[model samples]
Target: MTLHVHSMLIDGNEVAASDGAVVEVDDPSTGQVIATTPRATPADLERALAASARGWETWRETTAWERSAVLRRAAVLLDERTEEIAVVLTREQGKPLAEARAELQSTVEQLDWFADEARRVYGRTVASRHPDQRMQVLRQPIGPVAAFTPWNFPVLLASRKVAPALAAGCSVILKPAEEAPGAALAMATALTEAGLPPGVLNVVTGDPAQISERLIASPVIRKVSLTGSVPVGKHVLQLAAQGVKNVSMELGGHAPVLVFGDADPELAGRMCAAGKFRNAGQVCIAATRFYVQEAIEEAFVASFTAATRALSVGSGLVDGTDVGPLASSRGLARTVELVEDAVTQGATVQTGGHRLDDGPGYFYAPTVLSGVPETATIMQTEPFGPLAPIATFSTFEDALRRANGTPYGLAGYVFSEDLTTATRAAEQLEVGIVGVNSVAVSGAQVPFGGIKESGIGAENGTEGLDAYLYSKSVVTGLRRLR
Candidate 1:
């Protein structure tokens, strides 16, 4: 499809790249061109920064209620156009249409959450230690923000930064992933239609390094928010440090899912299958490493493999498609390499170990590998695709040691029916978020982030609001008040 793409949004108006160069966006599901976004030049980046500076001046002056009103309206508009936007997302990102719809709906909820939270950016007064003196603490917008969102969850991730920054009264210049830029543009259009003054949310697509360096160097952009890989996040952090800019980063994860011997093997299998295969396991917090207790490993592997093999792999737009193509050829190659390495190292491929060639796109079957050696390549790396490697643990302490062995500390999951055992496991997991008896973590209302090599800072929750705000303390002498 030849899409009439809105290339960029600057200063509240849709515009093209200054060099007239467009980045071709492909539909990973079909290996077809879906849209073209403007590849921003250095000049466009500078303009976006300046525009955000201008926007911040006005946006910061708006009452919290006014800002909340705008964000809430944007949320409503997003809900109204969920299908239209989700179709574009599904086509570009190659997540199943059902998942795409859920993402859009999630984005809507995120926007609404931040909007309501806007009314609660509270500051307080401290009791004066000195007589006749008063001290007050006030919260204020940080300034213009530069946000970079990844392709895996374009709409939802963009909102995670944009909504919170705007709600905290900061104007944002978003550099969305070139591979899936339409969702950002579509969102900008919705916010614009919802009465957002131009420049409050600027979408610029281009060379990430170029755009990021320019934006971070700009004194106008006070904060940077990123959702990408660990390397990319580190690079952004390094650039932002030169300007002393505040940054919020949500980076990589090779999450471990632990199944206790006492846990129901069938239940763990079903939950892990759903969590591992969603978006073809492209999720940052995906359950990539499975460590089932030895007593139940055989049963868990059988049930999980069966469930994974049952998933239908095809075009994301097709109705009832459970698994979609990898978002790029590179992802497919990575998945292939990881699986091949594990197999070559003596791991048994329980099911679906090869790439699907029935079509022209980058589709891989939902694979489940058992007896994955601790030294296998997939065991040491983040398989950001539809491949799950299962290893067995003989004891709870052994499982804990293996789970915490990796440098990644993003997310971890444990399944145990006993409340005490579940709670104990949750505490023992060395990750930012833990799912006990579940694979669902990182909700919109909670703080979402990681530790160690997974990158720094938090997004979502009240802390997310603080990410775009600064606190000011005022001391005054009330000599004549008495």
Candidate 2:
């Protein structure tokens, strides 16, 4: 498939913005403009929302079987076109092709899973105190939803919200990140080609603030979902609160990986490094912080540093590259700023520190910062980069305290073969998800999100369905006694 230089998918139309303004989508690997997407205007968003609102009545009335059929067909279509979608994703967002493929495949499975779940959605009947009255609890489509998804995991995160919303019989207006919209557009195309009703799934690409405000303020939109930074999430929540809109947020995370002395030091180092550096360390649940027991700190650091140094940083299109450039120029600048602040604050650069000048693209080498003070900016903030900050601790309680110190608690990890110690730490970790001896905390089958500043609500699994639907209690007269 040839990449379109610029385009936007709105209300099932592959059209350009009315203003005729296009934003360049550059490939971070080559610093070349791969494609251009429309810079959506306020008018564009209103049009999309209006179309969605008008389409919702028919969508909500569609039988569960009909919705499921369309969704399942979409899943099959996604599977067939995974390669093309993955390539577009890699070019737009600087993620490895393999990882992009994995994400795309996962998105297809997510839709299938939700489609199956739609058929199994069950309501229960309860006996009332009086024979004249019986009660039942049921779930129904909420209405048209506004899904605001981040650039990272473009295909997967959008599916995480859209799959459940469509399965639950709600139409959606998706506002994917401006920097990465191709994969989302591709998904929308697949759904439309699979016979989904026009306007049932709308895609809008534009400025975040203008689009978000219009979507949240619209009375026709009853639910809102987002996956992004903490400040953004809070702002969305505040706006949604105005209308009491049902909302689900899967926001930022400063995940910590605790390496206990009891674990294999070498294995722990390898896993932590791989997980942290995946997508060039641009993940919400990326293991940015490494907390190791004092006894094994030296061994873990040596192994981790070696692993980071060996990582191949280059184009995501390259076959052997394990790391790639940050998705956007702004993203690269933020990564540089955070690392520089830590270094200026007396942190030691253990392995990598600066950007590579050999390429036109924005490429930062996998960096590891040691002796980083807890008071440092990087330590306090979510370092959504390839920088790993390792701190040594003498006791479990101290590790627990340090892990819970940050305002953000999205995910936590511990590497310990000892069941007791791992269980204790997992229980005490002040986060929504925890991983033991592994950094793979994300999957379509599991509910993923965070606590505290990480954001509110959850995505994936049956829990995500609640975000797209509302529960109602029905009361009936069991007998005509009157």
Candidate 3:
């Protein structure tokens, strides 16, 4: 298959960098360059900013119904091209084809959800204490937004930012990850074709540092939204502080799964294993730490190991492949290092470990480590790969304490039949999302975000739309009837 030639989208047109420089796009499944995307320069960013300013002026004045119609059409367009874009996504991002299709479906759902939400940007009338006085609270778009998305789920994360901002009548300048630009560019194309005004949604691909610093520092940008690593999020936050821009971050997560003694150990293990290895465990909300009660540790570990070893790993383009290569060599190296560190710290390899040498791709065995010490490096760090660390807990309090031990707290899970046990675990787990007896914690209609260092604000649901809006209080005094 011929890969799509990616380019920067400015003023509703595809163009190369002003200096004619480009970045190579690699297919992780083969470790080969399959395509190239325009590397945006400072001048290109300036043009994008100016275009966004003009776009915001037009977009913010459009009626909410008009915005809703455009977004809904965009969703339909995306749905029609799901299979085509899924191929591009799988080639660049190294996820299984089925998973890539699912991501596209989720992206479509986000646009549709935001489309309906556009018309629901309601205002409220408040009763006035004095006669002949009226008060109203109105929600308005927060102006142009600078959005940054990661490569793990490029199109989905970009849609998470772009769909909501546009639905709120705000134009956006998006800087998608350089590794996987095709899917995001495809989404931009669909939006433009769906009657979105020129410059309303611009996609740029280049050096993340240069793009983020220039865009966030610009006076034209009023809001910043990002889905990336914690360090990158911190850097963006620091830059946004200079302009005092409204910021929303969905950063890194080292999620924990708690398996209580009363829970079905085999069922919990299988579920946790599935959640942990999805997308090769590149997910920010992936189950990284498995904390099982001591009474059921043996059974849980046994089942988890069997389920993990049963997965079929290969190229994303190949059918019947359950897992695919790491998105980059750096990811492969990091996964290897995490497992080695765990073993050195007294952890035992319960299943697959070490890199797979069956091909040239960046593939690692889906690994599981048991008896991991609390001091292991993997215990503290967000291992964004296919590495699972299992540790035993003696009691509920111990499990909660161990689960909340890390600074990151994006998502947590609990599997127990007892209502009190499940309720208490959900309440005490230091996370933005909790899944009891399940790992499906996110949806278009549900609020998705974290507290502590995980993130600053929420996304998805009404909260996601509100992130792009600001409230205005209007008070009007009427002439008294004589």
* Best-performing candidate as measured by TM-score: 3
Q: What is the C-alpha RMSD of each candidate to the true structure, in Å?
A: 1.1, 1.7, 1.0
Task: Write down the TM-score of every candidate.
Answer: 0.98, 0.97, 0.99
Clashing pairs in 2: 5-36, 6-36
Relative to the true structure, how large is the alpha-carbon lDDT of every model? 0.90, 0.87, 0.94
What is the number of backbone collisions in each predicted candidate, taken in the order shown? 2, 2, 0
Which parts of model 3 have CA positions greater than 4 angstroms off? 1-3
Candidate ranking under TM-score, highest first, comes to 3, 1, 2
Residue by residue across 1-482, what tens digits does model 2's lDDT show?
A: 45466566666788788898877777888888778888888888888888898778888888899889998999999999989888899999989999999999889989898988788677889988987888999989999999999988888889998999999989899988888889988888889998888788888887889889999999989999999998999899999999999888888888878889999998898888888899988889988888889899888888899999999988898999899898877777888898888889888888989987766788998998887888878888887878899888889999999999988889999999999999999999999999988888877778887888887878887887766777799998765755
Please say which candidate is ahead in TM-score: 1 or 2.
1
**Model 2 regions lying over 4 Å from their true place:** 1-3, 478-482
Tens digit per residue, CA lDDT, model 1, 360-471:
6999999999999999988887899999999999888999999999889999999998888789889988888999888888678999989998868888899888899899
In model 1, residue pairs whose N, Cα or C atoms come closer than 3 Å (at least 3 residues apart or on different chains), thus clashing, are: 12-198, 12-199
lDDT of 2: 0.87
